[model samples]
Target: MRQIQAIALVLILGGLGYALWVLYSQPPLQLSAGQADHVSTQTAPLAPVKAATDVTLSAINTLPAPTTTADAPDLTPVSRLPEVNDEETYIPPISPSVAAPAYHGDLSDHQAYLVHQSAQITQLKQDYIAAVDKKVARLESLLEKGIRHQLPAEQLQEARDKIQGLRAMQAQLRHELAQ
Candidate 1:
C-alpha cells in the first residue's frame, strides 16, 4: 500500500513539473533589426522631406524663328463698337411700400407654447431616467445577492412592460416636438 501511494504521488508531481517546464521553456520571440526598425518607424510620425529643385536642362543651339503669312487680315479699331448713354438705361430701385408679413404675435405665441410643452417633456424624460436607474439598481442588487431566481415571471414581465411604455411615451413626445 505504501509503495503504491508513493508512486502515485511521484507521478502526479512529475506530470505537474513537466507541464510547468513546458510552459516556461517556450522560445523567446525575436524581431530582426530591419523588422524592429520598420515597426518603430511605422509608429512614429513621418517628417516632411524637402524636394530637390536643381533641375538640369539639355544643351541646345538657337533654332530658326517661324515665318508669318502676308495674306492675314488687319485687327479692327476698338472705338467702332456700339455704345449706349446712361440716361437711356432703366434700373429699378427697391421700394418700402412692399410690406412683409408680420409674425410678432403669432410666432411668439406659438414659440412660447412649444417652450412650455418642451419643459414638461424634459421633466418627464428626467423622471423616466430616474425610474430606469432605480429599476437597474434593483436588478443589479438582486443579481449580486443571487436572488434573481426568486423573482416572479409576472413581476419581470411587468417591469419590461413599464420600460417599453416609458420609451414609447418618450418617442411620441420627441416626434411631436420635431413636428
Candidate 2:
C-alpha cells in the first residue's frame, strides 16, 4: 500500500511540474494596436465595438426633437370660455345631466353600511369556526373510542355526517370572509 501511494504521489508531482514548465515556455501574447482591429468582420463573430466619441446620434433617430416655444401653433377658440372683465364674475362649471352624487354624503353612508356588514360577517365567521372545532373534537373522541373497542355503526355514521356538515359550513364561511 505504501509503495502504491508513493508511485501515485510521484506521478502527480511530475505532471504538475510538466504543466508549469509548458505554461512558462510559451511567449506572452503580443498585441500590436494596429493589427487588433482591421475592420474585417470575418475574423470574429462579435459585433464591432465603437469608441464613445466615435458614434453620432440624431434626436430624430429614436424620438422627435422637441419644438421651441416660438414654433407653437395657436389653439382654435372652439370652447365657450367666459372672458372675465370683472374680477367677481366667475361661476363654477356644473353639468346637471350626469346624475353623479353632488356631495360625499351617499359615499360616506355606503362606507358605513359596508363596515357594519363586515362586522356581522366577522362574527358569523367566528361562530362557524367554533362550531367546526366542536364537531372535530366530537369526531376525534368517537374515532378514539371506536378504535379501542367496537362502536355502534349508527353512532359512527352520525359523527361522520356531523363532521361533513360542519366542514361545509366552515368552507362557505371562509369563502364569504375572503370576499
Candidate 3:
C-alpha cells in the first residue's frame, strides 16, 4: 500500500511539473493594435461554401429601391398637440340608458328578494361542502390504499395534502355558515 501511494504521489508531481514546463515553454500571445475583435466575413466569400453544398448562390437578390413620384400625396410634419388642462376637460353625465335601473320595488319586496338571494347562497355553500366532502372521502380512501399497498411516499404525501386541503375548505365553509 505504501509503495502504491508513493508511486501515485510521484506520478501526480511529475504530471504537474510537466504541465508547468510546457506552459512556460510556449511563446506568449501578442495582439497587434490593428487586430480586429471579430473575423471579417467579407474577405472570405461564401460562394465556395455554397458550391461545396452543390447549391449555386449567385449575386444576392435585393428588393428594388422605393421611388418617390410627383403624384405622391404631400405629407406634412406632425406639430406639437395643443396642451390639455384638467379644468378644461368636460366629461358628459352618464346617459340614462347606461345607468343602473333604480330600484322601484317596495321595502317589503326588496326584503323578500334579499331573503331569496340569501337562501340561494346558503344552498350553494351546502352543495360545495357536499362536493368537498366527497373529494375528501375519495382522497382518504386513496390514502388508505396507498398505505396498504405500500405506494411511493410522493403519491401518499400528495393524497394526504389533498385531504388536508379539502378538510380546511370544509372547515372554512362551516365557519362561514355559523356566522
Candidate 4:
C-alpha cells in the first residue's frame, strides 16, 4: 500500500511539472515593430483647426447694378389668312375602275393564289410519297432475289446514285412546297 501511494505522488508531481513548463516555455503571440508603431499612430486623434466665418452683406451691395431696357420689340397678334389650294395634292381616280378576276370575288387574289399553290403542294407530296414507295419496293425486291450482289460494282453504285438523286429532288420539292 505504501509503494502504491508513493507511485501516485510521483505521477501527480510529474503532471504538475509538465503543466507549468507548457504554460511558461511556449512563445507569446507577437507583432513586428513597424506594425506596432502603425497601430499606435492609427489610434491617435488629429488636431483641430479654426472654423470659418460667413461673408459680410456690405461687400456684396458695393457691386455694379444692371441697366433696364424699355425699347424691346412688340409681340402683337397677326390677322387671319385666306385658305389656298395646292396643285401638288394627290387625288385618286374616282371613275373607270378595272374589273377584278371572277375567282377573286370577296377573297383577295393573293389568298386565291395561295390556295391554288397549297393544292399543288398536296399533289406533289402524294407524288413524292408514291415515288419513294416504288423505290423502296424495288430495293426490297432486289435484296430478296439476291441480285444486288450479282450486279457489277459500277451498276450497283449507279443504282444507289439514282436513288439518292431522286431523294434530293423530293427534298427540294418539299422545301418549295413549304415555302
How much is the lDDT of residue 109 in candidate 4? Answer: 78
Model 3 Cα lDDT, one tens digit per residue, 48-98 = 454466776455544445567775677654665555667735466685554
Which regions of candidate 1 deviate over 4 angstroms? 1-149
Error of 2 at 6 (Å): 99
Q: Ten residues in a row with the worst lDDT in model 1? A: 98-107
Specify the highest-TM-score model's number.
3
Looking at model 4, report the run of 10 residues with the lowest lDDT sum.
Answer: 98-107
In model 4, which runs have C-alpha deviations exceeding 4 angstroms? 1-114, 143-149, 177-179
* Candidate 3 overall lDDT versus native: 0.75
Clash totals in order: 0, 0, 0, 0
Better of 1 and 3 by lDDT: 3
Task: Give lDDT tens digits, candidate 1, residues 61-141.
Answer: 334445566654675667886565576343566767744333344555887767766676676666665566555655455
Sorted on TM-score, best first, the list reads: 3, 2, 4, 1
CA shift of 76, model 1, Å:
99
Can you write out model 2's per-residue Cα lDDT over 62-175, one digit (the tens) per residue? 475688868978766667664555643435568666542233334669877677666766976887787788668867776676666677887777777877888888888888
lDDT of each: 0.65, 0.73, 0.75, 0.68
Weakest ten-residue segment in model 3 by summed lDDT: 33-42
